[model samples]
Target: MTLFGGLAGVAGAAAAVRGTSSRRISPYDLLLMTAGTHKLARLMSKDAITSPLRMPFTRYRETGGPGEVMEDVRSEGSLRHAIGELVSCPFCLAVWAATAFSIGFLFAPRFTRVAASALTAIAGADYLQLLYAQLQQSAEGTS
Candidate 1:
């Protein structure tokens, strides 16, 4: 994790040195990035479709909530296990997701904002879907 953070820091520093200095973050952009980071981290860490990417370092445990999957880290090697822990955890991967979006903002703000907006919309939609499902369940119970 330290290595990963160090590499991300180096990339950000290099980008800043190349004249893409840090820009003031707007509240809108901050919200978008937060939602984007959450969704992207969940997508990478828990989504069933992304399990293949984590397969090398993790073992499938069971189906997780909704479209997510539960995975256990392979305990063979330290580095591989560490990576497994990161890949299998949304909270852990959120740091990487946030850092990547930050770097993307430095390199290409417009594209980054667009991508973040899309992710935010998806996150919102996911919440709405869950709410809708809950309402349906409630209605059924009442009926």
Candidate 2:
């Protein structure tokens, strides 16, 4: 809870310091950010490629999904365990990812949009790939 509070405090401070105002975000940008946040959170938390970053705090368990992996949080210490849990849970990481992109949008909207668009595209591609694989499997089974 302290960590979450700290994040909220930092975001609030940044908004005050930067004079950020209440501008309504467009639906397109909102969707892009949502998809981008989902992909970014999953990539950071479960993607096999990013395991090295989480290795210190988590132990590799098994393959999770297509390119994702399951990991157990290390119970070495409070901070480390907390970090491990945060990095291992996509639901938890989503908060951080959304916060980061929100901050990025505040600081540099253009760059944030580009990055978010790329992540959103990747997320779309991932779904398509899964659908394709499922169709192929069905076709093979029916043959």
Best by lDDT: 1
Q: List the residue pairs that clash in candidate 2.
A: none
lDDT of 2 at 25: 64
RMSD of candidates 1 onward, in order = 1.3, 1.4
lDDT of 2 at 66: 99
Please write out the lDDT profile of model 2 over residues 1-143, one tens digit for every residue. 78778977887787878787454567888898999999999999999999999999999999999999999999999999999999999999999888888877777788989999999999999999999999999999999
Off by over 4 Å in 1: none
Q: Give per-residue lDDT, candidate 1, residue 128.
A: 98
Best candidate (score: TM-score): 1
Error of 1 at 19 (Å): 2.5
Model 1 pairs in collision: none
Give the alpha carbon lDDT tens digit for every residue of 10-106 in model 1: 9868877887765766889899999999999999999999999999999999999999999999999998998999999999999989988888888
